[model samples]
Target: MLRQCTRPIPRWRTVSNVLYARCRTTAPCQPISPVSARTGWVGCLYSTAAASQSQPTTDGHIEILGRLHPTDSATNVSPTIVSKTTRRLHLQRNHPINILKRRIESHFRDYAVMDSMDPVVTVHQNFDSLLFTPDHPGRAATDTYYVNTNTVLRTHTSAHQSDVLKTRKADGYLLTADVYRRDEIDVSHYPVFHQMEGIRTFDKKKIEEEAKVDSETSAIQGAVLSESNPIQPAHTTREAQLVDLHLRHSLEGMVRDLFREEKDLQIRWIEAYFPFTSPSWEMEVFYRGNWLELLGCGVMQQEILDKSGNSDRIGWAFGLGLERIAMVMFDIPDIRLFWSTDDRFISQFSSGQIVKFQPFSKYPACYKDISFWCSETFHDNDFAEVVRDVAGDLAENVELIDQFQHPKTKRTSRCFRINYRSMDRTFTNEEVDRIQDQVRQVTKERLGVELR
Candidate 1:
């Protein structure tokens, strides 16, 4: 057997349940596989050394989990472990009996069912290779967990999308089963979590045109399109946002159908940010007039697309927390309840029943924009914070549309388009202008900004 640890083994009751539910048999629960048994032994041996973990001293002795691999080009075993620390930290996990678990099985079942006929149906990938740039914080020893030598637990399922795109068949739909890491270990956050990442590529010009039309539809709401009311460049600034919004709505709709009793289900798009997506968005579900964020999505960045050999085509993708959705559906407040090992919680949940979700608008949203000039001492971010404080709930989207440095004064000028539209009622031009004036005053007082 591989090295083994004496510490209490985590009960695999949840894992067993998952296997039983999906496989409908105890085949996977039998004797440990030969390979797994070997790995267990290795883990146990390493655990004895590392579990005695102690703080490193200036003398330079560091803690290591296992010995160096034979392929590492080192024939001699070092007496001391090398020390390297990273600044960035990440925590990741997946939960037991949680919504995410249920969803994964659901998707897996659907894929299996569909593949029986098409065989070309996209399926989720489980394991993925991980590479961190030399400068990447994740590469630092202090920031991540080391699984064996080259492999580490995946942080997010999306991490494998690039790998799948490069290796998998290029035709038909493809999905990946991935997980990611974060620092928080709380009721809501697990050390690992599951994510579904999807990819598709086609003619760019055609997709771009389709995106242009969708953008208009998204921005106008219920407005009817006509020759006079044409979609403008401003409307299609980010096709990814609109496309993501579409996907979110469709997903939420399907979720509601799955739980037939749910009602008034609506998906609202809110601005969000992430490194991999431009013009990213978070989808919120309206619950009892309160909004709860449910999912994140956006168009894939060009760099990621190029790396996947789809540089010539456009791509879009998204990820959602299954637990968060389940929480909203079941009115569960603390995420820990799902993993509490409490028989009551699990028994209370409806296995295959639909729950009703009523949608209602509590507060109206308003948007406005202002142009101003300021010294190099302040930037758009600084200005946005000030606006957020003054506008409160009345403010919708605040963005820097234009920026330039003065050729003569050496000062900077920024144009911000602030939107003002309330769910309650439309605002008068005068009312919005007055609020704009207040924002301008705050900017001037705080950052020495001058209204343009």
Candidate 2:
């Protein structure tokens, strides 16, 4: 019988429940299956729950399991954005998005499906707690959505890592939520997208002993992992090596299990960097003739462990984009389709279903060009956020059709072509006209662009 360390992970908890981690080990060393590793989804990938800025002004809080109080700056977090097409996509039943999420989560059913948190979080939870340096780009207003100088819309589900780690609720968990980022306009880039964070910490000595036992699989697991993932200088060689083996082996099993249906799947690992972890690596899969990065992970930094009240534990964490994987798995051509509210889009998929998304009759895209004299501080991401805020999912593609510099004034002029289209139905000129007008007016006021 094959023997691998089967660590007993804790039950999942909701946001209202106290979060903490406590783990144990099992003796079974049965041959690993693609799904033998325990996994569960904590919540939705895209949250309908991020604190809203334009939520019909209450106490500036939306009454959720936890009240989402307004901070200072907000985007896409407003009730209008939350109530949009995203609410149609979730991890619950009858939703295709959740159906895909559950495929992985089913492997770890005992774990709690933790609900999402208020996107507005303290700067410490978002950055400092993760050991990000003061000058980190993520801390910049240009890259992250801030609720205030001291609070922000979480850029990743990992923003909750410190808090949950401190609670000691479960040694392993999967947190899924809508994360915000300032991004360039593209078919794939949305200011608000979904992400899931998976992390598991282990007792320092148990893992080392598990490795020392020299079990048949231990040597092979150890050798293979050591050849690739290295130990941190700060960690004891033996402990580091054992933890590394567990981390890589566990992740490999997860990837294989995730794509078990594919007979010709390709996967690889490459060294990478992250502020929170040492000896980091990014997992990539060969898909559609290109290598797409699936996730980023590494051994958990000791300081993070110390803060989480697990000073004596050694562990690992990985974060993945749900849309990235789901898109590939379901043969979805457009990132925006996942947010489709059309009955045509929703009717095809069902609860616990795994079906390739079938495309409906396509509508032609109407393009509108807006030329402007731009400010020195003009950012493409800032411009895209405006388009998203004004047009929501109807804004299909935002491309810079042309750009030039006026030599006499030393000013940059830009022309952007906005492709407006409806996935479910054809757009009338009158309908597109109103939206186009709104876009132009909003860009002028919000982006400080002088319409040319």
Best by lDDT: 2
List the candidates' TM-scores in order.
0.44, 0.79
Give candidate 1 regions above 4 Å deviation: 1-143, 148-150, 167-182, 205-260, 331-351, 354-452
lDDT of 2 by residue, 228-301 (tens): 45566668876766666666676666776787776677767655556676666656566555654566677878
Residues 1-452 of candidate 1: C-alpha lDDT, one tens digit per residue: 00112111111001110000011112222211111110000101112123122222224332233332222211111111111111001111223223334444364343221111110111122122222233544333332333333433343444455665675365224332323222221223332222334344444556545443344433324222233322222234344444444444444544455344546665555444344554544454555455544445555566666677766656555554444445445554433333332334344544444343222233444556677777655544455445434543345456567888889987777887776544334667787777777777766765677888
Model 2 local distance difference test score = 0.60
Q: Which prediction has the highest TM-score against the true structure?
A: 2
Poorest 10 consecutive residues of model 1 by lDDT?
35-44
Q: Provide the lDDT at 201 for model 1.
A: 44
